[model samples]
Target: SKTVSTILVTGGSSGIGKCIAIECYRQGAFITLVARNEEKLLQAKKEVEKCAINDKQVVLCISVDVSSDYSQVESVIKQAQEKLGPVDMLVNCAGTSMSGKFEEVEVDRFKKLMEVNYLGSVYPTRAVITTMKERRMGRIMFVSSQAGQIGLFGYTAYSPSKFALRGLAESLQMEIKPYNIYVTVAYPPDTDTPGLAEENKTKPLETRLISETSGVCQPEQVAKIVVRDAIVTMGLFRTIALFYLGSFDSIVRRCMIQREQSKAADKRE
Candidate 1:
């Protein structure tokens, strides 16, 4: 079994990130939760601690905007290492989403989504990669969405940011492989989370109708899959490729069904 003694999770205050933290804690890894919300970070720390196998297992929280400053993120990561020891696993779960047609969406919204969803993952990975390489042992997982795999209605601003993660994961995996570092990218379907609720407010009606066809998945379920995949000894490239294929298959199947339904309606007319 891969040794995952110390774990750091960004966006750990809620949603899939929080669930991943809890799952990792359950596996006996010391957890560090990072998010922009101090209150939520503290709350998440309390929840993660409950899953700790022993009192000695430290559950820490850092309140920092992952998209804001790399220096601040690096500082917090250093502090976390000092208290909890080296991070054996880093999960890049910090991200944001928005929904609108490209023309209607504000340009700033596109930049903001990219900053949080793409660079948010990049900054933390940059912070940890050097140490992980020097130690020649580590695992990194990026929490990408099914939206990342394929463009979707009203997600023009959100999809590209996530798509960028896939490119990062692939290139980073190859570069880090010789150093014994592993990278895994997760493509979870629309998950039931507070973030999803917020996105729903801005989601276009067409987007809502299309997304609903695939239904919603639980954060816990996605977290479980992510953790499991992260620890697997399978080649990083193979793992990531399979994840994309599976998500792509789901998308294609859903679209075909929608098309068939449209044709049936046309026939009736």
Candidate 2:
């Protein structure tokens, strides 16, 4: 019977972020959607406005790269707060993914992921944490990926950035718990989103094969269950991961053999 009064979501222009906004909007929360693209933000605002349950509900859109400048992120967040009232919930969903063999991935790509995935979450959290502490209550959510849990083939550049979110969540929880603020870190599986489709285009054969073994989930499906993933499943989850690691190893071996054979054939010509 309780409802969050104001919800601010970065990367809410698309993917799981937008869906989360819609779900919360249905509960009558005032919504603010932040992303880098102005067109997409407006489009997302229209889609989210459809789920409004009360005439009082409002959807605001702000376009700014969450990872670019801390001051800029803080400024936009302040503007959003001024318009929508203090943010009751801050969702850090703005992140990017790139995949390739460790040695093949451009060195710059690793730094880019850290900026988008780690600092993107940090800037917004930094901007709002102070106010949340002053108010003595709020919820902060980080949307990480399954890759965050176990490093996999071709995720050499992407996994660590996602993994960093868990560390941030764990440390932030301890500091904020005393103020009655809670942090939630969601490790969602391969989701069917534009981001995933783009990532697939560049994924290594090994990564793609491993991904097929664990299909994909729709955004709405993910948005529904991640809220409950707070349950302690680490013990069993790690055991299962080891089994998958064995399968992943075989997949990588198979791809290596195929690539070597193709290279040898080219030499004969």
- lDDT tens per residue, model 1, 52-160: 7776788888989988999999999999988888889999999988888889999899899999999999999999998998898999998888899899999999999
Candidates in order have lDDT scores of 0.88, 0.85
Model 1 off-target regions past 4 Å?
1-4, 233-235, 239-269
Error at 141, model 1, angstroms: 0.6
Write down the lDDT that model 1 would get: 0.88
The per-candidate count of clashes, in order, stands at 0, 0
Q: Estimate each model's TM-score.
A: 0.86, 0.83
| Top candidate, metric lDDT | 1
